[model samples]
Target: MLGALNMGAFFALVYVAAQLLRTSVAATIMAVSPVAMMLIAWPLLAERPKPLPLAGAGLGLVGVVLLVASGSGGVNPLGVAASAAAMGLSAFGHVLTKRWGATAHVLSVTSWQLVAGGLVLLVAAVLVEGAPPRVGLPAVLGFGYVSVVATALAFSVWFTGLRHLDAGTVGLLGLLNPVTGVLLGTAVAGEVLTGRQLVGLALVLAGVLLGQPALTRRWAARRAARVAEVSPGSADHPGSSTVDSRVPVE
Candidate 1:
């Protein structure tokens, strides 16, 4: 279950997001994942939210509404449900990883989850889809790329990043994954980026940026400064970058 949630979330979300919202819009939606993680962790892990991250989450909500409402198309129920499921599962998986392997090596965690998830998925596929897929060169290439680059390298880099930076910082950086997807879809798939989509995408990015540690700190410091200013005799503390953001589990 955990493994399925971890690996399957990425594949399922990407496909559905691309189909429902186009590649770029889908990527923008994914940029809001950190916000989702924070929310999920709140109820599950007793986490709290920082002001900037909350603002970013709000921005994500707006962006989602605008993007879905743009043009003749409103929100597609199936698409929204699939995307939400993908994100929710991803968030749950992350929390479980943190809880299950608080002291375990990231590689070990990755390996165990991948194996369990693969087996579960394979069994599910055999039961529902009814047959193994024909292995072709293109399929092989796709599998190789996802396994080597997306899975292995991504987790390695992520675990390393967790060592140095805060979760908000690392999470913000992870948004680059969706950005690459959006760009590639535009260049390779010839997907059109409409005016409304551009605007919605902008909102999504702005939200993600707001949720980053640096920006969140900037906002926090500014608020603190303002509070100090308004008060008669308060200590001045500039460059205090602590927000109420949740720390990543090791």
Candidate 2:
């Protein structure tokens, strides 16, 4: 619940700040979330990646660099400050989620966060945004899509996976968001993807593929088998335990 609420708060903060400034600047700031997640994961989650995920993160960094570089224009001080705050807050929340682990109930956490965030947005709409002007058809449609499909549906799929997976693996999957967003935005919004951006995207995808926990797990098993074969009775030894050490204790 803390994780979800923190993410929601971060999003809400960014969205509100965007409204108060330029959309591009706010987006750039939000892009920092992935990088922040990786940094936090290293210390807080003790995420020791073996080449692949780190490479993927590095690739993703290229994409992010391209994103920021491509958007270099009139800088708004207020926008910069707000975006930094949003990024920092979201990153901290991500670390907290990893620290808490997947034992936490996903639905309850998501729901509480949504409810809390929605309430916060409601208050902001009323007080800060000054009643939030009456929505036209387009705005109504946008809001509906954001609330229903983007927020509800995306989170449902994400939370389901999170419950069954390591936080680091889940975090790696986030690399997809930027890639998909860049490609889809280019296609749907008629934005052009430059050659540099394409290269960056490829690197980012490579990193994601490399860092997949499934691959690492498979490799680890293979290594363990080799070790057991070499050591003979190592697994049957009294002190040197297997991966199921927790089972006998529990």
Q: For this target, which candidate reaches the highest lDDT against the unseen true structure?
A: 2
- The sequence of per-residue lDDT tens digits that candidate 1 reaches over residues 60-135 is 5565545544334455667766776776677667765655666778788778777877787677668878987689
TM-score of each: 0.69, 0.71
Note the residue pairs that clash in candidate 1. Answer: none
lDDT of prediction 2: 0.66
lDDT of each: 0.65, 0.66
> How many backbone overlaps does candidate 2 show?
2
Best by TM-score: 2
For residues 111-209, could you state the per-residue lDDT of candidate 2 as single tens digits?
A: 666787777767766776675667899999999998788876777677676556554556667767667777888989999988877777777677667
Supply candidate 1's per-residue lDDT for 55. Answer: 78
